[model samples]
Target: MPISRFPFFSSKRRSSEAFSLLRRFGPSKRIQSCNYGKSSRNGNGKPESNPLVNVDIQAPRSWGTYVIPGALLGFVGLAAIFHYNDERRAIPKGQGNKSSGNFVKGPIIGGPFTLIDTENQTITERNLRGKWVLLYFGYTSSPDVGPEQVQVMAKAIDKLEAKHTIKVLPVFVTIDPQRDTPSQLRAYLKEFDPRITGLTGPVSAVRQMAQEHRIYFKKVEEEGDDYLVESSHNMYLLNPNMEIVRCFGVEYNEDELADAVLKELKRTQN
Candidate 1:
């Protein structure tokens, strides 16, 4: 064939070349991109090393996954803190109230009964109504435990009345009722406080009262065919309603006893 006059490509040939280049590197072709020289996954499920092209990648965000659980945990923690505070606030500030139910409130078997006091005045359950009573049960021959407890009661009563302007009737009931006649009890009580009252009755009656209170006692035999009674030394604090409010040791400190009695008084008043 003879040589053509024009050496440059024809328009159709130029258009074909342009089309081929676009097919190799056009917007429709898959592009790979990465950041900071770290490879990222591309849409083709392959690691990409290029940095200039746009890529679809995701990072963990806190809002959608963690926000709700964190909020719930915070709410639970705050509720527990508030509940503990409320329980601490509910503790008794003074003498506490008796538990409601099968528990006895006063001397278990106390009822209308006559007993000679320190001054030989007749006292009965009815006479004690509407007055706070501190009842002590023990024998005159009791070791230091009994007598010392009575002294504590006297002092505690005095302290409470002095500070809080409250009066408490302290009564000593004999556990060895058979041997502790009215006269013997009266004489023994004088060693404590003149305000301390003494009570004596038949053994059966005394046992009734002790049983009602669930107090334990027994008569131990001695050499003289006589017996010494070992019994509970509980000092019971009673409300004006004749209900047992607190049972404390005879040796309770004045502050502790006074606080307990005062708390009960507040409860009854309410």
Candidate 2:
């Protein structure tokens, strides 16, 4: 009789020399023994050994079957974490990320609309798909905000032309289209820069464009002049795809505007 740590299972070490001589190796490891000392053969022609009796090599079956697979899964999880971190770090700061591309390359913060240009052609959001457009939305009568920003945009385009082969079209979108008609816009633009093209269309279209660029404008009641209308003055830099890239405050400096244009040019070149 051999002792077993398992309560339900026991091992019978056959000490009979005749049985031991019939055994293949070591002591006879009786898988199960009948009280009458008989042996049974299974359908495979092998002895029906006891469940508790065998070489008992402790083959690390549990570790091989469960722990190794679990370890592999853990390794894959860790690798995924590392891969995500590496990709996140590779993105340039303030640029469009993998999620989507904005006009200026960050989170989108603008509106949408449709309008026409100087050519009397209908220009929708789709038309802006191929060229970088510097959209200037302001009133002609805006004493300081209107001309100053247009000039800054003109200079920025000039700098971009001098430094790179980028062709940026300056689009002057007038908020006071009621006062600044096509001829009025054309003349007003000449006073600042000849290259600046004035775009005037239907009032509805102008309003739509303003809404798209996140512009605020309203007609102010002036007691003396019926031709006067006040509007929110702002500049929108749009990408080749007619999307608002970035917006400039009424007080943005020329150098800052130039830098922004140049940065966009770099992104475009890339």
lDDT winner among the candidates?
A: 1
lDDT string, candidate 1, 78-158, tens digits: 999999865553322222333321224444434455666656677778889998999888889886777778888888898
Please give, for residues 53-103, the per-residue lDDT of candidate 2 as tens digits.
233222334557888899999999999999997555332322332222334
Residue 52 lDDT (model 2) = 29
Record all residue pairs in model 1 with backbone atoms less than 3 Å apart, i.e. clashing.
94-263, 95-260, 95-263, 95-264, 105-244, 106-244, 108-212
Model 1: which ten-residue window has the lowest total lDDT? 93-102
Candidate 2, which ten residues in sequence have the lowest lDDT sum?
91-100
Candidate 1 yields a Cα-based lDDT of: 0.70
Runs of candidate 2 with Cα error greater than 4 angstroms are: 1-114, 119-121
Model 2 TM-score on a 0 to 1 scale: 0.55
